[model samples]
Target: MKLKTLILAITFLATFNLFAQNTYVFLGSYNRDKTAEAIQVYQLDTLKGKLSKVTSAKDIINPSYLTLSPNGKYLYACTDTKTPNAGSVSSFEFNPENKSLTFLNKQSSGGENPVYVSIHKSGKWLVNANYTEGSVSVHPLLENGKIDSLAQNFQYMDGSTNKERQTRSHVHSAVFSPQNDYLFLPDLGVDKIRCYQFDENKKQPLVETKSPFTKTDLEAGPRHFTFHPNQKFGYCIEEMAGAISVYQYENGTLNKIQRIYTHPDKIKSGFESSDIHISPDGKFLYATNRGKENNIAIFSIDENGLLKNIGYQSTLGKHPRIFAIDESGKFLIATNVLTGNVVVFKRDQKTGMLKKTENKVKMENVSCVQIKRI
Candidate 1:
């Protein structure tokens, strides 16, 4: 009887693995003219790196940025006008089986144009960064994955040297540390990363850490940040200067170690760098450059967290605003807003490079791409 029971367990595990075949990729769009759905879902073929359209969430105006809950059962998005003093954050309950989203609730993002949202690893708190107003807000999550009332809000008043783009503070992204003990808010207009100690237990959850902030190069316009999986280093992609700043992170403090340019010296146009991400294995880093060089810049990370530029790949579309790699690192999807299409790329895991795939889908005003293994 014991032998029979062991065989049954092994058979069940094998069946489960066989049926888990696809991953869900969510694409968020700006929906400027309301002609396109705000959020579109697709099923990624794990083996072939192909994509098929799933259902989409409509009537969501300008859902520019999206974040999934830690459990993957919910999704949160920041929506509204890019102009100052308007916008909201919305929540949705996600169904893993059918890959569908049910709208849950929304709340004022506390400022204008909330461009980014991040959930705490503890699954109890949600944070948002408002770009136009240069502010941040914290909110609580309900038991059912719905967002509750706002908890705290803070605004930054300072600006940097760039008169055209840096006339005022512009908070672009807020990312929590690997341990969930700290939060980093990268301000594009001010050229600094605001460090905060995050404690969900307190009435005021986000407080200034021992090191309140770290200044990047003047006019750098730090836009997005990604932490190394090793938890020892972090990278901030600068928008205006088209550079990546590497830092050593320890207990909410950041020590700048290296800075690398994303574009070649000859290709000098107005800078419009967008996103940054590191591979799951912590071996490679990727940054997106938009202005004249519409490409994804690739870099290799060394043992000491320094970066070496490998090369750049054209996105094949205009304004590759955001892109995401699958968990298996087999494919990448780039959402190009100006071209109104999504492009798929096959990734060479051995050399950390990308090859354009034949697959392309037309989507209106695509802004962000996020992938989750189902």
Candidate 2:
């Protein structure tokens, strides 16, 4: 009887341990022509929703955007540069035991100034957005989590209404549909979201009937977008207008449903928007506003996929370039580019609001933040 009781107690403790394990945050930096910038890592307590630093920030070149594999074992970042067109994607193996990263390999992004990276659902392909060269490329990923080679490349030729902002097409982000059957490329320069049918076996993207993608006003300058878990709705953050657009997505096609301002209707400030994200629970959407006004605008999504503005929270730092929510949906980390600080926010699941936490990590010209669990 004593041995049986001891075994039952051990089982209970093991179950609790699994439940208590939380996610870790990984931050990407821009470096901004400096020598090199570091990618910061932190562990977030799941039960308490608290953040603590893990590895000392390690320096790397301009890593603007980052993505983790489905298994959460590998991390990929886009290093943006102009000299020698040094645009590449670097891979790292994540060591969850120590909350550290081990460098794996690097691959050319196939264009200049690659700003964003997205991995396919199957973990077999990577899609990159080339900001300067105005193109998108798909690359095959090896089993070892390294980029094998470029599989497909598509260039944009058209320009948008805004001359200064859109002198030429600038592909800002490339994302795959939840089903992984289509790829969506948002071009800030052309104000359009280009769609391509993806072939996993062929490792290539072919234009679909819903091809050439959908346009977002002539010069709205869509920067980043996110889809709801239901896969029926999507949201886009417009950079030039500081607006959020809601769309209805069906059968590989998109139709604009609604558009709303990111800022208060009365506040007149010259601010540009940067990133947009949807909560894992599909209850809220958050967007970052930069420039003279720095804050994150929050919105509640209705059952019908409409967005109703909740409020805006000051990022507590400058140039909130990009931010991300942890896998558990317990914490949000906002990266301030100019001031070089990453601030943590406790997400109120009930209210769908963000409260600034006491923990803030300092770094240089931080561009993106990603979080994963062990």
Candidate 3:
């Protein structure tokens, strides 16, 4: 009787371990001119950092960026359309069991060339940024996780000192604060991080915050924003300047703390900073630099929200448009657009270093990657 009881306990533990090892990684691509699917699903072996193709969603034109719902049951993408100066957003119900997607609905993104999409923590709002037309839109989320019509949209008219790149306001990323009380829109063309008050209780959910906006350096085009888990600090990567600005965040206000260069030695040209992400443990930060340098810069965050440059990891491909660390922080995947491949790297938890793995998957014109455990 004792031996039989022990055998039953061991079998249950093995089953649970197997179930926990499976993770879903969704890759979004610039499929406008490529034959690859718009969204491809892969089953990631977290322990070994291996990816196996699961399924895909095709015919989506330029799903450049994607965001999973808070519950991981729905997925949203910025459908960067072929229409001149206009684009839209799409919502899909994600089936984790089968690793498939069901198209729910689509709506105009309220501007042109939508580049980024982020869902609110409360699952009540979906916000997107349009790069070409310099606008951001906020759409409401329905009970079924479908996106409703645009609730509020704002256009920025300011431009920075760079004549070529900053000719018009170009909203690059729309990210919410950790507390979900504020929305930060990093405008690459205007060199300003626009802050807005977000109230999900209201029909028009987004409004200008008390301070309105904060300015970056004259030509420092802020492209993306990420908040520390503590909610006390924020970071924005400058696209044109190739630098990261650290800010002290409190109640919709951003106080610039420090601005550091992403490269070892700055180049006169060819610096287009792409994405920024913080580790789940809130101990390290990573930012990508495109153009001449195809690498991800790593930094260690101190207790005072200051950053110390650690090292850089080669992305192994050209134009690493977007990269994401898994929920467990054990794996990092970089989607290279020019090389048409996604490279997975194993992360060192203690030192926050990334070691390249042998796993590489080919997806034509891949632009974005998002991973979650389900």
Candidate 4:
């Protein structure tokens, strides 16, 4: 009996050590031209805060945003961004051993300037939102990670109070609810959150729920959203208003609970909040403010699922567009698009603060970053 117990202990320790050692970083950028490589993979040195380039995938233009499959075997990205009538979503087969991405297939995004792509939890469906054209496209995923033809497309025709920025529908992101039964789309032009019930068993998976959409503050221009780890709360960053709108989530509905501005008042950057994320432990939240603010707004989550502004940390560059926290919540990396720099930060678990490190990488027009441990 003692020998068997000793063997079980050894197996647990081995698994823990293996998990602690493997971390990979994926970055997407805007290509100067079609010949430039746009998607890159790097081996992240967690201890030394270094990024070692592994391989880069080419032949696709402006692969700006990226996401991985549930099993981490595949990667998908929005291609040809800012190119009129040429937007697409492409898939790649990722091999962890060789640390390479093999091009697979791509499907038209149904609209121009496709910005964000997300896969359903079941891994059977993939959806993308077009920013400039105000449209959403859905494609069925084949078993081998190849993207099939476009299935359904929805074009939104609406606008909000801001005449210059919100004169037409601009869908910024498509986020699936924690339950995977609903999809919440933050439309910057319309100033609303459109909700759709997803039935994966049917050919037409996206249908409007009883509550079709929720209205945001008149000129908020809701851009990106995230749900709390506990699944009881939701938060969205308003790009135009420069604030976060908090909501209570249930089934497929969002009830507004609180709203808070992310940055200090009267800054020169004027309020260009970009990305929002909650720590893995659910204790803290972080957001990036662009337009010369170049800082991350830090907040602590209370038990009641509300936020209290703790402090702000400089991203060490300008135009901090998108930032991501690793699954372990030990590190955060922010990408400054205009500055052509990606800066790393170590997170303090107890204080919920970020300290910048010297580990930085130079890449022009770096738009997005994601970290995952394999």
Judged by TM-score, which candidate is best? 4
Report model 1's TM-score to 2 decimal places. Answer: 0.95
Q: How would you encode candidate 1's per-residue C-alpha lDDT over 1-374 as one tens digit per residue? A: 99999999999999988676458888898886455688888888877777898788876689989989877788899988474567889999888676578899999998999999999988889999999989999999998988888899999899998889899999999999889889999999899999899998986799876678999999999999999999999999998889999999888888999999998888777658899988888889988989788899999999999999999999998999889988888888888889888988888888899999888888888889899875
Please list the residue runs of candidate 4 whose C-alpha ends up more than 4 Å from where it truly belongs after superposition: 2-17
Clashing pairs in 4: none
Question: On residues 215-323, what C-alpha lDDT tens digit does candidate 4 reach at each position?
Answer: 9999899999999999999999999888999999999989998999999876734659989999999999998898758799999999888899999998888898778
Per-prediction TM-score to the true structure, in the order listed: 0.95, 0.92, 0.93, 0.96
Score candidate 3 by TM-score against the native. 0.93
Q: Score candidate 4 by TM-score against the native.
A: 0.96
Q: Give the per-residue Cα lDDT of candidate 1 at 356.
A: 92
In the order shown, what is each candidate's alpha-carbon RMSD? 1.8, 2.9, 3.2, 1.7
Candidate 3 residue lDDT tens string, 195-312? 8998889999897766878999989989989999899999999988889999998899999999998877856677688889999999999999888889999999999999999999
Give the Å error, residue 3, model 4: 6.8
Candidate 2 residues lying further than 4 Å off, grouped into runs, are 1-17, 32-37, 56-59, 82-84, 205-207
Q: Model 4 residue 212 lDDT?
A: 88
- Evaluated at residue 366, the lDDT of candidate 4 is 91
Question: How many Å off is the CA of 126 in candidate 2?
Answer: 0.8
Alpha carbon lDDT of residue 43, candidate 3?
86
Error of 4 at 340 (Å): 0.8
lDDT of each: 0.88, 0.84, 0.89, 0.90
